[model samples]
Target: MAGGKLTARSAATTKPGTHGDGAGLYLVVSPSGGRKWVYRFTWQGKIRMMGLGSADVVSLAEARGLRDEARRLLASGSNPIEARREQERAEAGKPTFGAMADAFIDNKGAEWRNAKHRAQWTMTLREYCGAIRSRPVDEIDTEAVLSVLQPLWLEKPETASRLRGRIEAVLDAARARGHIPRNEANPARWRGHLDKLLPKRQKLTRGHHAAMPYAEVPGFVASLRERDALAAMALEFCILTATRTGEVLGARWSEIDMAGKVWTVPAERTKPGRPHRIPLAGRAMSILEKLAEGKTAEFVFPGQRAGKPLSNMAMEMVLRRMKIEGVTVHGFRSAFRDWAGNETRFPREVAEAALSHVIGDKAEQAYRRGDALEKRRALMDAWASYCEPPASNVIKMRKSGGGSAV
Candidate 1:
């Protein structure tokens, strides 16, 4: 509980991620690069983050005061997160829309890709949403949301669209936290609610990243197997699992279930903000095994810095070093999809499930409760086999004549 390790200067300069301020208080930088104050504590064996406020809004001193308050609540056998919520209910007469938005950003810090993303959320919710900021979250009706959006809707189509989505997300989070009535339809809901009111702006056709042909993946993976560097192994695992770059880079040892042979991508770390369990085939497990040897950091693919995961650029640098051009790390998902659809007997839904794609509407999902984990497990195993045949054990290609290994 000793305090004051982080100075204002150090706090400002620290890279995007959490930094301890002692006594469970932390300065958390979202991947998009906004700063938030949080108190990390345990309740019944599960660690929870109690958001104090955004660092922009709450000074370090104020955050520490909030943390002390939370600590006192915890000492008195109360869960700080729940206690904080209760305190708000009794004292604040329901959280303001601005407060809920801040909380949503704080909670979603990890899922954001970078500083630009953080800025967009901050800008839209803070500057654009000024009209409704102080309004009680539960009272935020469709017109309140529309007033903030309509001005920018035609002038800045992309920004307005994203703002609408972010607002919807905040309302959704509000409903989840019981700040708003669950039965009340979201004021920012897109399809049935906003679609009728807001005219569809002209759309742009976004191109997918270039993909390496599925036929070429095995050879590319073999090239990857030739190196033992963390980035190389990380890239190989990314390809094998058909996961996103951020997911692989953000993967932590805590999320790995070696016994179950699965990597559980937590809700906060996923694009959809849903937990995804990826089955690890033997080849993928072998990559993890290689990295696990002598691994001491929390991140399985540890970066050069102590206790940090590899930089977002690290795997891309691997591709650059290999002199491979045209294809992207994400494009591997396309290759995997092509292979699954073209070569295998697996159902399309099973293939999509393997990629953690959300399929079907709420009603269909309700009836089809299972994630098809077992079927996907078999699908992933076959995909892994295609990438690197199990019998060879990913034979390393050592260099000849005193050169670096291939």
Candidate 2:
């Protein structure tokens, strides 16, 4: 304990140690700067320290009053700390967020496609989730998750989005392992949860979007094919090619090479501002062919305007049309990424290039300048097949009038 009695000013500035007051009341600052008020006293002839509250929340005067109460109880041969414990009846604490995150990485890290994946998880949890790292996994609520996200959510949207996803993943693992109650909804959940609170992430992302779980994409694709709108086709095309919304909407016939089975997105339309050559999957080719016939406009998915491409909100409207909930058009890229990373054997570089993300340090990026087109083509093909509509729900696309349910 520090030798001198602490005033409010000294207590706030005190370094990591126990700062004392006159009669067993103290402010204990941990190495991480977490300060708590404690009442040090004798309980049943053994020394005991009872937590009053966090120093941030509890005042020195209140702590002194609590110390006085403890002294009163001590004179009466009662242990104030044990009495408080009995009154509170606190639950046994579960594993902390940091410990759970460490376990999650150790268990799931091997399944990740790249070594950097582990590093990303580790760094995000350690740096971004520091507020909740010491909190029990079960104790993490929406407020706690929001505390970690709200500050970074705007300025560093990409990092904030990734950190939220990682937190959700660890909490999900905790739930599945029975660390949390089975019926408890995850606080870090994005759709219908955090999306309701934070700024719309679509406008903030750098072509990287919040993802729907990959396992549900195929079913969602099947639902999309049932619609007849051009916007529906555009959304499906975005998924099949694993390209961004603007890239899919802004595509022109000139960019498509039917013979080569490729679509060359010009530098202007891409996220990285570099021309990207995407090999067409058979499903994607079919989508192009279906949209091509009886097509009079230059843009693949044209708006009602004289020569303009489809409005960016068109696909989002398609979601509303279908009454689909909790999914976004750009999120398909993330779903595609998740599928490639976890379910496929394709190397991480191929998947990254397919998404137009120029990963790796400068030299590694320079060495990987080829874009790994053919390898990515294979990966895209596999992903396309994975997203194939269920046979029972197939709605054939007629060349003239769009999709028909017959």
Candidate 3:
């Protein structure tokens, strides 16, 4: 205790003891000689000490004011310590846009089957939206979104479109978490809102993949057979099975069931993030047999590297070497789809399932769970037959208008 009743000058001079100002407010002095102001109070049979300020800095009058406020809070049944902590916690919960985006990616990345997909999510947002990363998520407005997207909207239409979708997803997630107040409309939503702000993305005259006309696929497959490279065999397998380039090149011997006559593409290797069962046709199985004669690696089509899959460009390079111009390896799937729609009696969903495409909306997909493997086997067999028509079935110089073949 201070020796006597203290004035401001006396409190400042008080050494190494707790000095009172006729109330719970006191000046605490340590033996090592530091001064601080504190308020002492009682609530519910407990004595609690609350720090006010250093006595050297806090005048006597200021300490009294703080002491009175603490008393008022105690009388009203609110603990000042708990109230401060709750306020601190609420502040801590508020995250800036960049921090929340990173958190969202980490949280959602696990569900994404591909590691590349997770990288793309972070890479796109960081590259495009660095400007608003430090801003509070609640303050990210339509103008901020437009500023990031407009530059790339026309310049890089596909990437910009995907970025807009990702941003919308992140914003919706933030809103759901109460990190941001819910707006009437999302700034990044495209349908009726952003469509007005930005110019429409130009529609392609041709499909995105440079597809050869379905009618020419048989002739093309015949030409592909002339080449004897491993890429040629891989491309033919891709065409016969109607599978993606990645799935065909990344194929492992273990994933193929020669007995069941099926190739199971795992979820990580597929676009739809689900395991797909491809009903192997005779031609597809034949190609696998040729490769299996003296297999050297885990991959069905191994690259120059010992155990790795073929390079992404290997099939495209094979087409280039064959002098096939203006076509992509991926375009074969489109050709298969077109032929299935136009020339075949197969149902559209069966064709879609053959290509491992997610048909229709979420509700439609939920109801149509079956992959229709048996029906797809028929469609694939027919497709294989069409790609390599038997010589006996090839009709030359058909007469027109009720005349027999010449």
Q: What is the lDDT of residue 314 in candidate 2?
A: 76
Q: Rank the candidates by lDDT, best first.
A: 1, 2, 3
Tens-digit lDDT track of model 1 for 1-406: 4358898778777899889989888999988989999889876456888888889888888888888888887776566675555556658768888889998888897798975466557655765675677677998999998887786565456767988999999999999999888889999988988988988865532346567778777777887877878799899989999997767877888999999999998765665556789999998898788778856557777665333467656776787788777666777888889889889999999998877777899798778767788899999999988987335555443221111100
What are the per-residue Cα lDDT tens digits for candidate 3 across 244-315?
776787799999999999999876567665889999999999999988985756689876533346765678
TM-score of each: 0.50, 0.47, 0.50
Stretches off by above 4 angstroms in model 3 are 1-207, 389-406
Expressed as tens digits, the lDDT of each residue in 1-406 for candidate 2 is 2233778798788899888887788889999999999988765336787898998998777778878887877665456764554344335546778889999989998998765566667666764575577677888999999988886686458878998999999999999988899899999999999999998877774533445677777877887877787888899999899887667877889999999999998664555657899999999999889988857567788765434567656787787666655556667777888778889899887888898887889888777658778898899899999998667745432211111110
Name the regions of candidate 1 deviating beyond 4 angstroms: 1-205, 389-406
- The runs of at least 3 residues in candidate 2 whose Cα sits more than 4 Å from the true structure, single-residue gaps closed, are 1-208, 393-406
Clash number for each model? 2, 0, 1
* Model 3: ten consecutive residues of lowest lDDT: 397-406
Best by lDDT: 1
Candidate 3 C-alpha RMSD relative to the actual structure: 21.9
